[model samples]
Target: MIRLVIIGSGNVAQHLIQAFQKSLVQVVARHPETLHSLPISCPVVTSMNEIADAEVYVLAVSDHAIAALGHEIPGTGKLVVHTSGATGMHVLPKHHRSGVLYPLQTFTKGKPLDYSTIPFCLEADKKEDYLLLEQLARTVSSAIFSIDEQQRLALHLAAVFVCNFTNHLYQLGADLCAEHGVSFEVLKPLILETAAKVQTLTPTQAQTGPALRGDTATLERHQSMLTQPYPKEIYQLLTQSIIDHVQKL
Candidate 1:
């Protein structure tokens, strides 16, 4: 079995520990107490010096801390990988074999995830290292892709628009519902249907709303109903965007 020494105790690290429990030899964290919540059997070390010999060192820390943390690892020969979407593989210690093992999904601590469905984006400095990364990735997830640094960064940008922005819109909708004395539950079916539609239809094809239909009167009334400047501004911007997209189509 290919042993892994995961460094960090954050959301990505915890999830990875669960997924690779069988191969996980040890977990290195600055605060060992942060890992107490996890239900893993692997030994947890507070220092990098205590990290056991392993085939791969998985740095599941923040993007900013990756380079500094990479320097602390004991050896230069071991394969070191980080779970950052925005960071490039070159940020890791130049002496060690560097790679990226970014998972293309939003991670919330304590939330259950099916590892098989989560896409694992892999990159490495050497072909053999990439193959080894792929071998490790396949152990947990079947949805693996060999993406380069630029492509990975682009994908991360797209993910923010689709996931983060969409969730914010949902929160805005919930707030609007609460303000008007309506149950947000009423919109649940519509939300689920809209999501389901995009599975088979392209986003453009799935598009529907007063803005998409060019219903100026309805759009005006909706805009007038929004008292808050922020929501109103967002609505106007999105309405104009939808109109522009339709005009381009």
Candidate 2:
């Protein structure tokens, strides 16, 4: 049995805890600020000092604490992995076998994750630890990739642009619509379709609109329609990028 200890009770932790429970693995849930709450019955430890006898220790905490807590784990061989996409695997102390187990999808507390769909981006120092982590990951996710620390960091950077920046743009779109007396709900279909497209279509290949086609009249009309600087700026930048992307083809 791969005894697992999860070191945080946040959104990612909740998703992982449930996923592991569904697989019938022994798991310990703990949190720094809040009590671990899951209706599915498991040992919840409130402090780090209480942790004992774990084959795999998952540090699901924020990026800041990984180093310090990694220093405190008094062993040389525990498979200590963090659930951070940005932080490097070596952030853990060299005394222990370290790795990263970043789940590439956003997680929310109490919401069920179809673990089978979520990609596990895993990396480890030792071959044995790497294989163990991969096996454990495959139990929860069908897609498991053996990524290096460098590749994981690059993917994390790309995620910022794809997920984070795209969401920010959506916010800008919502605000632009609201100022024009348009309902935010009206953008919902476009949003859903945009997400669905990238699953099959390379985002650049799926690109559409006046900008990609260089319909200057419609582009001018879009700019003119935006009465405010914010939306106008976004329109200008993205349209220019689209034009560039289309020109490359």
lDDT of each: 0.93, 0.79
Q: What tens digits encode model 1's per-residue C-alpha lDDT throughout 14-42?
A: 89999999899999988777778788898
In terms of TM-score, how similar is model 2 to the real structure?
A: 0.91
Write model 2 residue lDDT over 1-249, tens digit each, in one string.
Answer: 467777777777777777776433334344434433565455666666777667888887779988987776666777789989889886898877898889998776666667899989999888889898888887888999988878988998998998899999899888878888999999999999999998999987688888877799999988888887877898899898887877777
Off by over 4 Å in 1: none
Alpha-carbon TM-score of each model against the true structure: 0.96, 0.91
Candidate 1 residue-pair clash tally: 0
- Off by more than 4 A, model 2: 22-37
Question: What's the distance in Å from true for residue 108, model 2?
Answer: 2.6
lDDT of 1 at 77: 84
Among the numbered candidates, top TM-score falls to 1
